[model samples]
Target: MLMALSAPALAHPHSFIDMQTTLVMQQKNLLALKMVWTMDEITSADLLYDAGSAGAGSEIWKKLAAEVMARVMAQHYFTNVYRDGKPLRYMRLPSEYQLSRNGNKAVLEFVIPLAQPAPLAGKPIIFSTYDPSYFVDMTYKSDRALHLPAEATPACALSLFTPKPNASMQAYALSLDKADAPPEEMDLGQQFAQKVTLQCQ
Candidate 1:
């Protein structure tokens, strides 16, 4: 459930939350991840997702959202090769998926397709999120040492989101190319923790 909204912060009524790594696995050598996203009081809520119903403003929102998601995903991998660049190629989803909502919480799920199938042996996969605002906040990050059995195949990946604060705003701006600052140099995990601490205080 959402806490009582403070009037001052209400100017940015919508917030985006980063979901921690919940599960990672390999099926027949392929790697899959699942993620979720949510928001607050965002207008034309239909435009709130990477792909969804759009308002007259929906096209603007869609473009901004795509850029942000692409950038954040790149930062997590410690590369600027965004979406379809080398090292890691961004797998395109249908772009019409809906965010899962329950009361005040919504889940934005992101799936990343690995460049190669997970090796039969264990390997390290680094996952991270960064807010591209004045502070370049990081919401969550973790390094998963994955053990892939011989049978692992390419499977779906997932990540989750809740409505924290400034998440979607940052994403929205990136989608629109109106971000206030370049992404920070600090590692995504440290940057995100610092941003949250600063905001919560």
Candidate 2:
């Protein structure tokens, strides 16, 4: 009976990343977000190899950085920000960004600003990061990866939540093809995303 069943092959993630984010606030008002993504050794190797072949100080690296930023911009930085349950909008492209090779890994850093700074006088804010297609695995390297500067929000508190998908959902995510967009009802990445909450007085 087992021989008679055919199971479709799934495309799993080939790249891994350790991510960190910092909430940027000014005078108790959320101003922007700072993010750092460090790619795993294998993935970084390919990028470094390409850069080397392009020659020393080649513009290829910068071009690659721009291309990468463009893709993430299309996906809204793979980020979701909410204040009091209302979604916040991105004011513009990343205010600052750079991509560089660090030893055996590649690191990307950028800052994304909000359309209008949200006052956190006494409100709660939620922020999450996930790739909707689940083509790449993004995880926080540690609890300390998420930061809030005390000077900007003296009375604010921060909490981090890292959720893992259950067996069924994990199986579903693993079976998805990279080329196919996940169905509307299936948010594979969201199931395993890291959530950051900020509460201020």
Clashes of each: 32, 0
**What is the per-residue lDDT of model 2 for residues 1-117, given as tens digits with 9 covering 90 to 100?**
011111223464546778988888886689999999898887676667767755433588787677678877877888899887889998659998877877877788999999999
How far off is residue 184 in model 2, in Å?
Answer: 4.1
What does candidate 1's lDDT look like per residue over 1-201, in tens digits? 122111123222224454433333444333444444444333214434434433433555546545546544444522222121224343544223333444434344455555455432333233334443323222443322222232232332322232343675446434433223334463222323321100000
The top-ranked prediction according to TM-score is 2
For model 2, the superposed segments whose C-alpha errors exceed 4 Å read 1-11, 53-58, 176-184
The Cα error of candidate 2 at residue 179, in Å, is 6.3
Candidate models: Cα lDDT each: 0.36, 0.76
Q: Would you give me the overall lDDT of model 1?
A: 0.36
Off by over 4 Å in 1: 1-14, 22-24, 27-30, 40-88, 94-96, 134-190, 193-201
Worst-scoring 10-residue span by lDDT in model 1: 192-201
